[model samples]
Target chain A: MGAGLTLRLRNELSEIRRLTAALDAFAEDEAIPSDVAMRMALVLDELLTNTIEYGYPDEVPGEIGIEAKRDGDMLMISVTDDARPFDPRKAPRPDLEQSVEDRRVGGLGLHLINTMADVDYARINGRNLVTLRLLVTSDGDGDPVAVAT
Target chain B: MSDAGNQVQATIGSEWVDDVLVLKPSGRVDSNNAGSAEAMILGQVDGGAQRIVLDMAELDYVSSAGLRVLLVTAKRLRQTGGRMALCQLRPNVHEVLEVSGFLAILTVCDGREAAIGEVTKT
Candidate 1:
């Protein structure tokens, strides 16, 4: 397997399953901690879900790209899509303490993405690119079972 | 209730005992399917199921979308004098709830019996 992995999928909520599967396979190959893998699965799922659900105004299909590589103690992941420009960093934080009746269902995904990983956004050449960095450590299991693609 | 070869399959199971509705959702809950979950649970609640308990022992994963559904269900129940409880969450799901502060506000118990007990306490 290459030291880095890249994947592209159509912009649709159903495609998140494929993205998450690929991420888990990479994490297993790299022997990342289970908790770390779970977190990354979540962050990427949210990011891609957002791009698919809200990124396009015309309800047209678009392509979304994801790349991940292990960098020492950090696993850097990037997602690029042709969706409209929306910076998640500037999105308002969900007031988690609000009463259940007052809480809105739609805003928590962005909040989780911001809370779980270090994220950066850039709009370059008419595409929305999101970069997320997560701190990862091996589970210290000696027999690392690296799976092949 | 599953996602992929690597992710848990998403499934929602339910049981009715006495006057309470117990739902067991397994696998991943995200933007892809959260609306269905919300609709199903709230539909039951709107149909006049006053007491609900979510047995989460087999739940492998949950995102904010799932959390939103739970919170909305609970709030809806409260408005109609209904009650809801959650129990036996997997560590990751529990962690998400904790970080989001849902653990503090929602009724969480250790097991199905406890959750049912909590919901029926009144």
Candidate 2:
């Protein structure tokens, strides 16, 4: 499933939900674990929120595109946004050891994305591309299996 | 858009068994509308509502901003020796609370009566 939406916060969230729901449905139909589905959704949400907040911080009109596909036993979710060339994967990971009060609030979302999914990123032709891959398997005690594309 | 205009709706119910405040919220809660929800709950707390029950049955979604409101409200009520409880959480919202480790700190109930009973007993 895939969709492109404007960068407005309010409208973008709805679009994010819609795209996630579609991905969830696909996962369910393929008997993917609910936790995996939810995790994938969170990764998508974080990436899209980052794009809306920082990718277009100056309110320049932009577009965010989300695409999800099953490749082997893994679910690959990609989010692309057109703004200044910023690659999230290159950003330094937040220091989780610090106390919440002392920790910076902004970078936690990126940390969550990195920790939860196999995150990859690149800047291609002035657009930021982020791909998150999740290996799907049984709820417990199974080898990581990749879904065929 | 301004954060203040975020959509938030609240429904208050008076419980007969205990004079606790039961609030039901619907729509999205983000930085924009979190203040409204926080203000509503804080107002009830100030109005002598020692025991409060939040019926999240209709609450479809909440962001970090919304979570902050709940945390601050819980802390404030705790300072005054009051109690707050949440009930009937939708699956998605429940997942969020669980993932954030807030389920450990917050009193969650299975139903409205249980939530009321919990707050009153505290």
Candidate 3:
């Protein structure tokens, strides 16, 4: 597994894509389905976008390290960011059932991430670590198709 | 950021064929400078280029900010009883539009000719 990505919001978007592609390549090597790989990419993009937007809003440079490994049937994608320790699990989930006008905008990113992946959160050594586990199945039979990330 | 030195570029070309206004856009549109792109296209609408056909054949990527501008443009055109169509979207951008539900709302065509035909037929 490779180590960190220096946190610069401007270039983080492309880095997220790069990391996702690397993980997808790994998944393909393991014979993971194409559909599942695409979903994982979308989830990772939304999560990284959130970290760039909210995690370090002040634009203070930080580092985001993405590590991926296969654990049984699940592909674990962990993102570690050295920003202010804020647990996304504690953040209020958006009310998806509500009308768009009534619903809040900011929480949708986290809500999508939680709904799409098996999310685990922790604050380790002054860094926020978010682990997202996606089940790789030949047959698509897990969670419902989430709102676009 | 100065708009002049910015790398983001947008060109809007309009032509009327059978009462349909076709607007072709080329280059990137992102957070850095979607304002000019928005203004150029929306300005055409303001200048009586109704029933607009947006040829996104050359467009590479569009960020959320760019998407927002498109949404506003669509809403405005809808209110005025004018139509807007997007044609020949790149694969990556098509995915973004699909995910955002813009595919459901916007009229997407296979090519510029098809888009023009659709707008004129309606």
Candidate 4:
């Protein structure tokens, strides 16, 4: 594993295409398992989509960066945004038990990332940084098992 | 050709499978195109589509934005006394819906026939 890939993105809806391509390439290069890779891509999509939608107010033309790396048995993803100081870590989980009429889309995205990975968030020097630790090729334990590419 | 990869695309092929409106969405649905996708599906509901089956056999990707389309459509159908079912979801898509707890509210079937059956049942 060399230097991981980073994507420089704008706070635009179309930027999701570039973000998806970057995640696909990162998953392919890292030899990540299919299921884990799928979750990774979708969760990363949720992150970028939320940022692009709510991060920039008054058309701030926000600059966002995403870096994907393999750290031991974990595939680490860091998303940094020069937007508002919202921390995804503090987001409340939506009631999954709610009925159809009661369900709301307010917090489903954060609920998803929490379900899929170990998440960390911080506001460093005006940028919101969210770090996600995703498991890779684990044998149900914390240990990494060999997976053929 | 480079611009091709930068553009977001998703296909929603609509057909009537015997009084049941079937919409097949393929490719990716993200923030870039979720609103249009929502309209494409909601159009049927507004046009008096009583029973709709979302044939998701070809859909490969959906983010939270895409899920919002389904959720809103589902809520609309419920309000209008219409019915909808989803079938042929790829494993990843299935997992995403399940994680969002949509499987409990919306109908999910193993195949198109079953989905059609679910929406048509009075």
- TM-score of the second chain, each candidate in turn, equals 0.90, 0.86, 0.85, 0.90
- Steric clashes per prediction: 8, 10, 1, 0
> Candidate 2 regions off by >4 Å?
A1-35, A84-115, A137-149, B1-17, B26-36, B46-48, B57-65, B88-92, B110-114
Please write out the lDDT profile of model 3 over residues B2-74, one tens digit for every residue: 2234434456556777667776666546544556778877887788767888888777555555675677788
What is the Å distance of residue B119 in model 3 from its true position? 4.1
Worst 10-residue lDDT window for candidate 1 chain B reads B1-10
| Candidate 2 local distance difference test against the native | 0.67
lDDT score of model 1?
0.82
| Model 2 interface CAPRI class | incorrect
Across B1-122, the per-residue lDDT of candidate 4 in tens digits comes to 12223544457999998899999998877666777788788877898998999988888777787888998998898899989999988877888888889999889999999999898887
Q: Alpha carbon lDDT of residue B43, candidate 4?
A: 79
Per-residue lDDT of model 3, residues A59-84, tens digit only: 36667777766666777778888877
Best by DockQ: 4
Per-residue CA lDDT of model 4 for A1-149, tens digit only, reads 74778889888767777778877788778777777888888788888877877777765677999888988778888999998887777788888898888899657887788898898999898899999998887333212345999
Clashing pairs in 1: B1-B9, B1-B10, B1-B11, B2-B8, B2-B9, B2-B10, B3-B8, B3-B9
lDDT of 2 by residue, A72-112 (tens): 67887777777677776776875545432343444545655
Better candidate number, 3 or 4, judged by DockQ? 4
Where model 3 places Cα greater than 4 Å from the true spot, the runs are A1-17, A20-28, A86-112, A138-149, B1-48, B53-69, B79-81, B86-122
Query: Which residue pairs collide in model 3, if any?
Result: A7-A62
Let me know the TM-score candidate 3 reaches against the reference structure. 0.60
Q: Please give, as one word, the docking class of candidate 3.
A: incorrect
iRMSD in angstroms, per model: 5.1, 5.8, 6.5, 4.9
What lDDT tens digits, residue by residue, belong to model 1 across residues A35-98?
7888888888878777776788655778999899988889899889899999988889888787
Chain A TM-score per candidate? Answer: 0.88, 0.75, 0.75, 0.87
Q: Given candidate 4, what's the lDDT at residue A128?
A: 92
Pick the winner on DockQ between candidates 2 and 4.
Answer: 4
